[model samples]
Target: MPAALRITLTTQEHQTLKELEVAECVPRRTKQRATALRLNAKGGKVKAIADYLGWAQSTVRQTIHRWNHHGLAGLWEAKGRGRKPSWTSQDWEALEQWLQEPRSISSRQLSQRWAKQRQVFVGAEQVRRILKKKWRWKRFRKKPPVPKNPELKAAKKRDLQTLKLWAQEDLITLLYLDESGCCSESPLYYGYSPIGQQKSISQRSRKGRRVNIMGVWEQDNRFEYTLKVGTYNANSYLRFMEWQAQKAMKRLFETGKPTVIIHSGRFNPSCQGS
Candidate 1:
């Protein structure tokens, strides 16, 4: 038989190991206890303990040496050994403060400010991640500008009130009319797609087709007006309005004094009294 490697531990060290085993505060304490027992009581060498436990010989020796020197505290691993944080708490606080500012800022602008103010260089993607994840921010695109005309708004409101009053008195008349432009060349609707299926090529075509649609709608049914002109201008729209009014009058003459409501485009003067 090969000679056995002798292992030794002082009485004080053995007593401390016993206390640590009893405490069992840290993770892997049982393993540490078994190692200590094999070393102190069973006279198992470092190599033997390592072989039995399937750990490195240096690991076994270090565990025993740590318990001998620093007692229980040495067995616990040090903080921040696995992976370092991308940004510190202070950096996060600074970023939040910057985001809370009233002025609208782009990602690139924020990145530049971060470098100057925090003295830390970070990419736009990192800044975006911090903003979205940490701050729960969302991106918004501004809406298209609407034509502002206070006079027109006031006139429309007045017209609506007048129509409502006529309606209550049983003198109200309503006609629904609208014109829509249709095109064969559809507008591109941009949106996100999964990574692998993303399209890389674009389609190009110079000549496309288009058609215009015009119609009138009422509570009961719809009256589709002729395409009239290729493009419906204010003149063509006025003509459509005349046609709808004449049709309504003829129906009212035959059906008696029934109330009529006219819904027409802004450019149509059909609502105006003759």
Candidate 2:
């Protein structure tokens, strides 16, 4: 068994609690908490206080402890305390904007971004809980845009069917190619830059120096890449394809398996220039 806790109160504190216990205007829960604390202060045991107030023993002990720790303010409910709100209206608005499509940033990324933006620390789980409970945000697959021309749409469906046949026959291995680049003055930077802090990535501005990367990936854990400076062009794309082909062939030859490389990417009249 543990020693019984004895709460000692000052003359003013005892009197204040006594008044609150019977005050009609005070909320019922507040009165109960006040009475519980008062009984404890008068040298009542935890069980005695709980029985007298019709509250749990744990509740009685917690009430007295809160009163001691926070004085009068602790006796009353504090705004935004306990359990916590999902998020403020402002936070919800910011979240909506952050989750706008084509930017496939995950919940973890948004949580980290918000912490940096707000200068307050929070976890990814917290972000997920709010999104799920409040907004009911769920994963939705992004589908490719349908072509307005019926002929083009049907042609794509036919090509897809042919590719499915090839896949079933093991005649081709589908590999996806993607490329991207970044440069300063991109104007997409978001942050909570503190005052008097240097923000530039480099000591001096290198605004026009562009970086280019091309990657090839497929199922079965096969992948390769080409990275260089300058713009993505027809020559650059062809060279990347050739490099990936040689690597893929050498690997497959060692394994005594042969596969035809089938590249996947959109061909647009507009990208007649990427």
TM-score to native of every candidate shown: 0.34, 0.32
Leading candidate by TM-score: 1
In model 1, the runs with Cα more than 4 Å from the true position are: 1-146, 188-209, 220-224, 255-274
What lDDT tens digits, residue by residue, belong to model 2 across residues 96-212?
A: 677653444566888887777754355788776555543433333333354357888689779877865775676666565666667755524233222333222212223566886
Model 2 bad stretches (over 4 Å): 1-148, 187-207, 248-274
Question: How many angstroms is residue 47 displaced in model 2 relative to the true structure, after the best TM-score fit?
Answer: 52
Q: Write the per-residue lDDT of candidate 1 for residues 119-205, one digit (tens) a residue.
A: 778888867644553343333222323554889979988987787676566564545566665666554423222223332223222
| lDDT (Cα, 0-100) at 70 in candidate 1 | 65
lDDT: worst 10-residue window of model 2? 196-205
Tell me model 2's lDDT, rounded to 2 decimals: 0.64
Each model's lDDT: 0.58, 0.64
